[model samples]
Target: MFDKIKNIFKSDKEENNVTHKNAPKEVTVPAHKIGPKSQDDTTTYVIIGASIAGVTAVKTLRELDKGAKIIVISKDENIYSRCMLHHLISGHRTIEGINFVDGDFMEKQNATWIKKATVKEIDPNNKKIKYEKDGKEEELAYDKLLITSGANAFVPPVKNLREAKNVYPLRNIEDAIGIKEQAKYAKNIVIMGAGLVGMDALAGLVEIDGIGNLSLIASEDRILDKQLDVKAAKAYEDKFGQKGVKIYKNRMASEVLIDEDGKVKGINLGNDEIIDCDLLVVSTGVRSNIGLVEGSGIETEKGIKINEKGETNKPDIYAAGDVTGTGIWPLATKQAEVAATNMAGGEAVIEDRFEFKNTMNFLGIPTVSVGFITPPDDTYDILTYTDGDNYKMAVIKDDVLIGFIAQGDISYVGPYTQLVKEKIKVDNLAERVFELGYSDFFKIKEDGQFEW
Candidate 1:
């Protein structure tokens, strides 16, 4: 499947060459002006959500079809990177500072942004969407619709977990603000689930002053089990331990203990252990926001289904980003661009579907994991290089590098990612896998461009 996807990206170069043929001619327009639909504005592109995917789609559509109307509908008032919410909680960045785009992005794109609006339903049959803004409901028509509604944090079905107050999930900017506010007065803070988001929550509060006992509960044997091996995870576990962060591994929160005021007081573990918790941050996982397309005749399994062109089952409707469950930031951006190009009558397809890639920087320790962390069976050969705090590991199957992990020093992440994504064979390399660099694959073209 991955080889096929990569081949598509290589072959699509020809398709991209003809994109401008179908694309509308460039038109100069005044900045900060979103005029009424003109006679030439035959296509109205309505996008849902305002994060990476929706925002990228807006920019791509405008660049492809200058005269097309672009409307962005989002429940979030401010457009900020959800990935950087931890920075906001740690006071490393403000709400405005976390924005991934420029301050005048909407104005520059000549797009209409409808903020703080709740989408009620998507009427594919009528080519309209019913959404609620302020106190009234309104409907918006569109020639093409892109759903980048993203995902919502999932809270487990622990007893009293839903009804308890002072419990938050670190998924949105609002959640970050609430967590930061509560952390100020929290006596004992417990973060449930030790995945990426759970670790992010820990990273945000680890340095805060006056916070009482900080604890992390993970159902897996070690933290970040999906992203790192036991040894790699132990490096971070040791760092968190040194910082007085209590970690309970192989445990699950069976119930939420509440105080008299319905605020979280403690949590009961599945093994009958109880831990005090003034504030609880749930980061188990996330589920796509597919409610709008529930009855809109769009096929969905786990998330909104889309073809290579980012088209849903329904015509003129597309889905991208977390709504399609491609949670990776880079993949979401690529999917949005593909959807936008197709919507603007250009030719494009989602080419890269490799998802097992993640980078982490916690406690000042940088790490990058690409492909699989563990081999499927004993047929794979594993190589390792370690020097002091720096560690690098490579998994090879049939001479082809299948997975890689770099911890402490991740300078070779780019080459490692390329090698992994392209399924390059490393058996011929005279140098060790850890010594791999860009020079190994560097090719200087006549145009002074470096190709790998």
Candidate 2:
């Protein structure tokens, strides 16, 4: 891990000048205490999404200056960790264990929280939000509104799907809880899609007792294709098979077999393959929610179009996290902090580009990938290794390192991502790189340091 960060700093061979590393310093947010700092400003910042970005945003704003009013509104309490849902599904950790936060945590930060409101609409020009809770319609006005309303689960369209019983999507707290309740009645579990959540769900399933058979199906040829190269993905899929997890690739679930009254009996694949399963869990994909921005005057594309600073088209209004449709959570979360800071009268920014990669446990495969992007054509130099059970690979492009993948006995994900995010070129040659190692220079920073 230390070596990887060293590579990032040493690989500063880019054409443009990037900021040098800054020393660790204290960060003070304004939302902690209301004050008359810049303008006639008794601004109320309403932020949605409470998982990561929302919590980070509220805390960030409070720490920036603590002079602003922050109201955090979400459909649920700040307890669920979406990242850990797969583990919950696998039975490695219970839903109660992963969800640690609640209303009290926010109160300690001097912020007001609306725990059970579902945002219905946004009157962008009027600077107001419409929501519903307990059968009551409520409208809240804000001086500064931060829309961090996150993404939603992508439900797949399969025949007899609704008729099938015990169908679950591993996402929010409610979903995990539902799956847990249903897991007891079923022996076999079929998790659709071999993506991160599906793989993690399988990992979670292995830890649970009374789970007779677990089948993982991939519509694509490999798992985590969006985040890893073919070879790396293959290695992990092989690992899944070795773990006694059934692997079905290059096929889509076409029809869900249901009982007479309608409950999942089994699922039929595209190739006329029928697999029996007592329960079905889907982790197909995720789509950003743009309803809050619709007709709200915020620039709407595939995602909410925010300026480089995460500001929506309207003044004093910013949107971040999944709703911004930025496609990157870290960037979205960082943008939330930046937007919150700037909203509270501080210096903050958002960049136009960022690296897209994720490295979590892929079916218990010690794997990580960053910028492991295979360009349109075979144009870059690729270096890979697989000595016995160990595997490692580095990608260099245009005389600069562009991406790399590390697995089993490899620990350089931090440096690899930082290097890709910065697009830094190494002073050492590719040979020297694998030899000298990244720890010689790169640095590892925490999530909210305002680097990159």
Candidate 3:
């Protein structure tokens, strides 16, 4: 699937022998050189951020309207996937390897990319945005605007944590780079919040050599409390334990011990235990970057509020991805496509707002979780299948399969997700839920294609 999308992002520039490593930070394609603009193509689309959602929107807009003016302004100079930052930290992939798009993506789309620009203010009334790049401030006008500013990692309010040095969040490429550099010399490295990001930090650090003591702190009873149940989480936790990693569960950092140089020396836990540390990685959580639309009449609660069509309260304005607090990668891309389609005078709406589905492969163990991990009440029927190293659980309510989890072998879990998403009745198949596959729900059409 990713290979197909990557091919769509490729252009003739690849035939001309261009590489992302040598691609320029900025690319400006003349409007006249693109083609004769039509009446509908006169719209100017400006997108903020350069991550998955922003880039996906850019591609969608260009595909829908070839001659439309597309401008992508981003604070990051390099285009890389935040999800792959752990690979970068582990020295598994380079900066260019993490890029999701092709080297000539901007050039192929005929878009203008303003890299390393910090957007200071957005003026929805005037349809202009003020930004600074290389110490110079500039303003740009747009007919349609997209805010995919993404999110920032939340640093907990641990005592002295904010004021201490050698602390980082694994949300950006720079943060990963900093952690990688510091890991070479640090005597003790402690990561707070044993969520996916913190586990990613642990995964990356374990691959590197000369890393002294390593420990993980989780406020919950088990790691990945939200994504996995206790039994499922234990599978991964046991793997980490075998890697010589210390696990501290149901504990919070009460204070950050700082040396005279204002650097992190260790951490004081709520249980009155002190763990020595020279570096700390905070992976507690993430909050949307909704400050860009603060006074722009764009309604916001936990994040920038958008309708089903991804339209903001303001006219001609749309928001997607993490900026809307839809942190899931697939959902973000879907939202971007829907928003871009609407901006191109088309109609699209998000049908599936369900965000509980997630798949992860950590330490060679693949797991899939959809909907609820635990039943809200005893009214729901719970079924399980456990063998040696594999575990599977299904939560059924009435006749519908509401939740499901598969660990060790996720090969036949596709139908389970479909069952949960489509609210399919699985009364007859409840006993063999783990054995379900696409064949159970799909039939061959006249055209020799499978239809669901």
Candidate 4:
């Protein structure tokens, strides 16, 4: 079953500049805190969301200033990796193994962790935040505030969807747990959407041995339409087809079928196609939780609007992570760092950097995409290479290395990403396309700089 996706093993050599080598060794389980600490007389740096953004902010702030108090409030009861929830469903990793930061992260950073708490109102005038937890309202004072509330799953409007008992949305640990438990007894499962959520959900579901029939429906003509072009989508389609996951595209589900007992049974497509299934999983994208700052007079668009320093229109208030509308891992971490630095009285700016590099190991296929895989017009020079299921496409304009995609062997991704980041001129090597190597376009100098 894995042959179509799996291939010869190769050591992963792609990595970014960030490092997490010194994360706390002792792991601390997240728990609820009733309110703010009464004894702490120091300056408070309050951050919302204990996921990647919040954690990174507190850690970075702690390193810059030791005396300031850092408080992290999370609406969830426990801290878990949103990205690793699929690993939990697939049984490839235990719940404990999905910790995004080191176990002892909070303790080492000396930051107070508040769980299951929702911020109700942000009072910029008094520098106070009113929150509700466990049916009680409380207020916490802060010198600086960072909102990283993240996003919530967006479920499209479908008739009778709310009435279905077995319909689920994959967003957090609890959602993954519910889906995993339901999959045990479910003989047929229908998944909606083909984006990241749907793809990850399908990846995990296919790993379960008891899965009988799997169906995926999306409005796009191909899977991962937002992330991949036609050829790349075809590659993934073929791989998914080999796994027995039936896919229906160019159709939107109009109604969710419910049995007499109010349980999910199937779905009615716009084209009058009905897919029968015992479980329905909705993976339609997400919407940023920007409502927390909506009425507070802070600027916002699709996400909370912010400046280069992550500062909102309100004084001493900033935003980061998915709430800022940029929802990628590396960018999220960088935003957190920049927000923390300015909050700690240090000067830092979130520089505008362009490197369209993203990699994914969906199912067993190693896919790497760099720069612009799709060009708007035919004037751009496009080069491609294919070997069986392995594929590569390089998009070039004006003799500069702009974008490329390496599906199977991604060992060359690091160098390719570096070339794009550096904006190296490739006019001299137009004929030597798709051959990414160190010696092909660069020469190492004694000063550690590579000459083009």
Q: Which of the numbered candidates is closest to the native, going by highest TM-score?
A: 3
Better of 2 and 4 by lDDT: 4
Model 4 C-alpha lDDT per residue in residues 1-452, reported as the tens digit of each score: 11111100001112111212111111121122112323444778999998878887886777666777899998976655676677778887776666655566687778998889999988898898989899999999999999999888888778988678988899888899999999999988989998878888898889888786999997888887755767887877888899998999898899988889999888899677788989988998788898777568888898999899899999999999888887565566667778888887777777743425556667567776766766889988878888987888777877777777777776667677767667777755456767657787678899999886
TM-score of 3: 0.89
Badly placed stretches (over 4 Å) of model 4 are 1-41, 352-355, 419-425, 428-430, 440-448
Per-residue lDDT tens digits for candidate 3, residues 48-136, read: 99987888788878877877889999999887767668888889888887787777788887889999998888899999999999999
Estimate TM-scores for all models: 0.88, 0.83, 0.89, 0.86
Off by over 4 Å in 3: 1-41, 428-430, 435-452
TM-score of 2: 0.83
Candidates by TM-score, descending order: 3, 1, 4, 2
Q: Which has the better lDDT: candidate 1, or candidate 4?
A: 1
- lDDT value, candidate 1, whole model: 0.81
Which lDDT tens digits does candidate 2 get at residues 1-452? 11111111122122211111111111223233334365344578888767666876877776654566778888876455566665566666664555434435677667888888898888877878899988899999988888887787787779987557778887778887787777777777888988777776777776677766878888877777666677878777777677677888888989999887687888999677899988888889777888866777778776777886778888888888777765444455566767877777776676435636655555445666667556666787778778776677777776476876777665656666667767777765466646645655445678644333
**Considering only N, C-alpha and C atoms within 3 Å, which residue pairs clash in candidate 1?**
none
lDDT of each: 0.81, 0.69, 0.81, 0.76
Query: When superposed on Cα atoms, how far off is each prediction in RMSD?
Result: 7.9, 7.6, 5.6, 7.0
Better of 1 and 4 by TM-score: 1
